[model samples]
Target chain A: MDSITPNEIDIVRASSSKINEIDFENLAFGNIFTDHMLMCDFRDGKWQKPTIKPYEPFLLDPSAKVFHYGQAIFEGMKAYKDESDDVWLFRPDENFRRFNASAKRMAMPEVPEDIFLGGLHEILKIEKEWVRKGKGNTLYIRPFMIAIGTGVIAAPSTQYRFMIILSPAKSYYSGEVKVIIAEHFSRAANGGIGAAKAAGNYSAQFYPTKLANDKGFQQIIWTDDATHTKLEEAGTMNVFFRINDTLFTAPTSERILDGVTRKSIISLAEREGIDIQVRSVLVAELVEAAKNGSLKEIFGAGTAAVVNPIVGFSYQDEYFELPKIENSVALKLKDKLTNIQYKLEEDTFGWTVKI
Target chain B: MDSITPNEIDIVRASSSKINEIDFENLAFGNIFTDHMLMCDFRDGKWQKPTIKPYEPFLLDPSAKVFHYGQAIFEGMKAYKDESDDVWLFRPDENFRRFNASAKRMAMPEVPEDIFLGGLHEILKIEKEWVRKGKGNTLYIRPFMIAIGTGVIAAPSTQYRFMIILSPAKSYYSGEVKVIIAEHFSRAANGGIGAAKAAGNYSAQFYPTKLANDKGFQQIIWTDDATHTKLEEAGTMNVFFRINDTLFTAPTSERILDGVTRKSIISLAEREGIDIQVRSVLVAELVEAAKNGSLKEIFGAGTAAVVNPIVGFSYQDEYFELPKIENSVALKLKDKLTNIQYKLEEDTFGWTVKI
Candidate 1:
């Protein structure tokens, strides 16, 4: 929203640009990075001066706490280029707030707003050209913090590292998505770090997701850990269900992430006078709806995909294929949300911030 | 159990040893490492050559999956120096098996027995001097694996690194240990990564443990995530409760770790004709026992600390101080286990492996 104070961060220019050697149109999500990245360290109970230098590898001790104890958290956001080549970010304050919440939950120090938002603005200003001007083109922003202190003891780290690395992307998923409702494996506990964007939360889903992949499914719809009956999340994103034109999504809790796109869709749907209900959707109710031909659609909402529509889902060894319909609510909400993000529509909700 | 094939491992000796400048008697657990470390890489769908090089920091990309997704697992073991200058490992095969089980749960490659055990033997041979000869002295073995691939995507990495670092230690805990029974926070979830030694499971407890530390409690006795009615674990170890003369511990399940020391203690107690029961212990029953003077002792069992006795416990604003007794079942079991480990007593169970 505002210019970054030059004194707050040290800048080291890259000797050469790698932009000319790359094909931006065929880029893979989170694969290709910009020429520069942001980094800051925390030691002796305070954060050091920030730095923006050439993107490269760094050294760490073998006993860094992140390797042994998994004290790491991350936030995912995206930068958009408008028609006049002006860059914008969608609800960056939300990501910044959630980042510190994750830090506190993981027992790491909270990052100041100046370092989180100011560093983001400064880095995006330096890497503006990487944000291509197109409807689908975006520069994925990954702001993460990790425990860098060295010790094999099972305790919180005294030192940490905060970094911002940008990757150019097209889209995250490209397929007819099929998911499995988890009946055994779970992603979070009753009072766990599931609400936080902790790195551990993602890896916990990998094995289960791989199992679903082997069965021709792309992801999983995680249910309640104690009683695999209530739906919670879809893969790494917040999930939603549409039955009889009434949309239902689980409210955020200790076992569910508060996704940015998920909240925005709820707000937009309410604004457009759509029947959106926020409550726990039961597996039994979903099966009954599918059997009675009341289930219309299922989708996942997060920053990565914005809204990922599911073609079908499997529960208790029975696969239910969703009916093909026109004017899908998921695509409609995605269109409205992306229009505001790309500066193609009026910003009635005031969610986007100019970089 | 057997000598490693010389060709199977590449040894790079450290130019100098740091042993001359240290105080081993006052050593803090897992703070300092030995002169050499073992490393192996998995890429192209298989583990590469194993190497034992000087202990040092290594380079990694800022976007390494281990830093972003927490795709990591580890094991804890120890090497004991007997009276005749011989090193022996207690149930190393158990640690190796558990390590691979953790790997599979986290979607990482399973290390072959030769590399996991053979590489350990080779490294121990090189750093045998680090294993101090005393009843309390030990060379702590920390074998871990982490995702090394560079990407911000939420998926399993194709590349991984397995490493073994040795830390000489005297003991893991000191002073009286007071525990707080978990009423809100939980360590693991049902059908989750609780059974695996995944790094995430440890960090999740740091925040709650800090809260306990602030209240003058040294550790927390975690309960089941579903209801918080059943006792599960203590800090990072398996917990045990001695009511009257009967010992009880929760059985290994999807939500509890199958600890090596825990099993050893059970076996040792059974051999001594002590009443041992592997079943879930409820909080209400424990409180009732405390009121009736039947709860004799409560302790933790793990690789780092063979047995850690609790001085007192607090639950729901009420504290119960255990009565001091001369014949502690915990100490007796610990003495017997360590005696077998140090070759002071006969190894009737065939649990020790010569290095």
Candidate 2:
């Protein structure tokens, strides 16, 4: 491999015409791809030039370490086309920092901020056509890195592949989700990888989530491993509950992901005088709140779906159905975030990055 | 994607011409390829026909869910060629069961028993030559499954690929290892993927182990998540400690893997008149044992290396360096195990299966 200088990224333009087959209105979460993709190779102790190339398949040996050992990490963010037909990313720098944080934990090389931001900016320029304007339409950008070396010794790989894939997405998760409080299984340990958005972090939850789904619950509200008493997070999304009138959520810890949307909600809730309390919410407290009808609302926050309200929950083999209230906090937060995303409201926090 | 029968799977043979180039010696772990590879697909709620094909790369779209979600599981075992040239697999059924167990936790499809064993038999027949003779030499077989669907949703993928790749090799990890007794970091939790050979389990440990490695330790002896007091398993191996002539190991739980080699050594130790204790060994207790000079030997048992003796261990800030003995249990167990593996001893235990 030839050494690639910073200025010589070799960003070849897309030769093929833009995608015209798929109707954007019916797009799912991560099915459609943009015309261009961003890539950078990590080898010989440094990251190479960030390249923007036409989206295509890259070659990999069957024995690639990532295929076997799962040395991989990823970040999920979206690019939205405003009503005035301009591209924007919501807190792109935060996404970049979180991506590297996940990389450090996964034992994969971290992408330099300059390289990460540069590649996303360059790719956004080329793949701007993929970003749609209407409500619930956006270009979902997935930034991921994988250990790509051919040698597999049940150890970490030497080389890696960093690539950004673009997908047109509507709702990341489907419908209003009902979750079960975990009494037997925990999502992460106090010293585990729950905070990072590594690919393996999600895969390990599939089985437990499936079991919960089989019991008619759509998700799991995972608690701490030492004691399954304090609520940490939903398997993917960060969860918040309304106890009486104060909005309460678990504080970010090693076992809980520091969600962008979760942070946004804290700021928005404070601005809206919602009396938000970012602290541990014990299951016993939740159960008590439920018994006294003080559990006003339960919601999940993430980039995919801004804020999704929970309808019900199960605990200790018993299910509790939640009442859907009009003008809920979830709906209000979703509107606020989406409005800022679509340039319908002034982004006072400067959360949106114009492309 | 046509329906495949058992006989059709057997019909595909290893290419006779290419078999000559394979060298049993000078083989790196997972670096040498066998003539034929074994494969089965999980779709529509069943594990369909097992096939044997020439070792080659198969195509997958870049958007395959496995690449994004890390929904993959794998197993490692070996096929030994005895002095009489008879092929043998050491407890392959155990590997199959573990593979499926990992699949269940990862939410990947379960592979049928008949197909799994049938595929192994067919692949071994074609690539029999890859199985080497002499002690510590055999065909290292890796059976793995990965979700292969082309969508990036955070849920389970509908499709999966179950495959077995063979590698000619010596020991996978070569060393008289040194490990750090974990104080702050942990590998698995109370309700985690530690019991399963899920890819995430391995990926989650890389960063923590790297930190330990930087401190001159070869591995980290992982502790239970609830309390960092008890010793669990080592990275890629199950551990055993000899304190005051009593063999002690942690009992297998939801947080510890049911390692095949660990079980084998336990059985072998009992047959050889070694006092064994299957119970938890707390860090403070072990440190005390080291202080009183009761910590005689520390060894790790796994299929890859058979027995790897630990030369030292580090706690919070204290370091315990073990002295080398003339003939320890580690060497004796390794010799006995490898002797049976090379067909130098009577197969009284019925652990070896002839193919």
Candidate 3:
């Protein structure tokens, strides 16, 4: 494990290709992968030289801290291809910054920007062919860190593994979604790991979200843990509400993720001179707005789906069906973000990086 | 990938033993593992054959769900050796029941009893020599489950791996522990994964616990998430207070783990005719009792350290030192539990299982 300087990266090319076996027409979101992956190790007080090798299973000691204690964090982003086969990344710097923030909260070492962004640059260059050219098709990039130390003393790990894997994906969800406002179960507490892209944050919602699914809901709109009166976020996504013409979303705090897509939409809305409010959104007010037909549209903002529209929402015994509008904020924001990502529109905000 | 029946266990003995290389005199808690481990995999909607294989590194896909989503749960127990060379387990059934309960909360498949307990029975038989005969020396058993599916999806993994590993451990802590009442950080919410032995629960404390450690405290006495008013659990342990001659502890709720050692201590205190109270313990009242000299003893109960005595506590810029007392409840309970565990006391409660 030689120490890696800022700009050096070791590469090992695969002997053969597995890309021909993949079916891009009916691709699952995170299933199929590219040929190569990127990896770096934090061992003996410094990050070792990063390497791009053929994507394969690696052997780990059974007592690795990651299997016993959840000291893991991940970042999700996507690369889109234009008609000319040019690759573009939508705001990879935000994901990079948030990845380190997640590491700091988990008591793990942060990867340097050179190692993170530089390694991604090298791997994406090699695997750019995996980025399919279409409206919703993409090469989903997952950069993650795990505690790979070989002891299990209920403490932070000394050794860490940071890796990037690429998987081709189609749109996450096909149609409009229905969600239930969480009343009993809480996704995260005030001083917990809700805001970070911590691994445990997603797993904690699976059970409660399963209950909502059983009751005919596709997702859950989680509320604040203290009183469950203020809406916070949806499962794996940040939520936004459009009341009449004003756009409202919960402010980012220790309790809510400062999502990349949510901020992008806020910026785009500001550019469009639309009324935007970032504050505590009360469930009572949202319900009242729904009753008075002021709640025009509801959608989720995330890296996976860009924007997912919600057709209806259920609260306790009453279900509110959101009125369909000719011009939806979700559709407008999704189209703008996608156009920038696919290189169809000018990158005025410099949100997309070309490779 | 063959299906294993209830009574069938495939065994693959280690080619060579690493036991000679290990130093029993200076063994860390979970560092030195035995020669063999038990494993069973859930694949394609059914659990495969259980196997007791030589302990080795496992090859996992880079996209394994456990690394990305933290779909993992674990249990801790111990095995003791008597003078006659008979090995004993203290309430293995309790750990088995709790493991499945944890699995349920994580939306994972419940491991069959035969796979869990039977695997433990076989592993103990093969590595009985790891159970050292001493007052504190014992074989610490770690049973854990992890999501092993080859995908980067945020949803729960369909494939699972259940494993048991053994490590020789002495007493966990060496001195009297010091803890601070948490004022800002909360561990779990009213409807979160606090009660489950989920992997994330331990890692979540590392950051905040490090804050207490910096302030010279060894652990933290967490309060309720709603207001941080009532006492909850101490760092990974159930807390107890001895006010005057009565014992008090927080009642088990969704926010607190139902610790096995806690219940055992309650039963042992009942048998000794000591007054025991299980209810909400307010932090204000606890502070007042300490100030007035009614708080004689504060201890933590768990599987790692049967009972860990606390010397003092800090709250809101004020540190209170507890006067040491003769006939301390922590010492009494520790002696009682270890005696029962090592076959030095009567087996009146039917707690130990001899193998």
| Per-model CA lDDT versus the true structure | 0.93, 0.82, 0.89
Q: How large is the i-RMS for each model, in angstroms?
A: 0.6, 1.6, 0.9
| lDDT for each residue of candidate 1 in B281-325, tens digit (9 for 90 to 100) | 999999999999999999999999789999899999899999898
Runs in model 1 deviating more than 4 A are A1-4, B1-3
Off by over 4 Å in 3: A1-7, B1-7
| A222-262 per-residue lDDT for model 1 (tens digits) | 99999999999985679989998899999999999999999
Model 3 per-residue lDDT tens digits across residues A1-355: 1124434888889999898999899887898889999999999989999999999999999999999998999999999999899988889899999999999989999999888887887888899889999888899999999999987688889999999999999988776689999898888877788888988888898899888889888899999887889999996789999998999999998779989999999999898788999987899999999999899999999998789999999997699999978988889988988888899888889998876
Task: Place model 3 in a CAPRI quality band.
Answer: medium
lDDT of 2 by residue, A207-230 (tens): 899898888888999988888899
Model 2: colliding residue pairs: none
Per-residue accuracy of model 3 over B250-352 as CA lDDT, tens digit each: 9998789999999999999988888999999999999999999999999999998778898999999899999979999889888988899999999799999
Docking class of 2: medium
Worst 10 residues of 3 chain A by lDDT: A1-10
Ten-residue region with minimum lDDT total, candidate 2 chain B: B1-10
**C-alpha positional error of residue B300 in candidate 1 after TM-score superposition, expressed in Å:** 0.5
Error of 3 at A237 (Å): 0.8
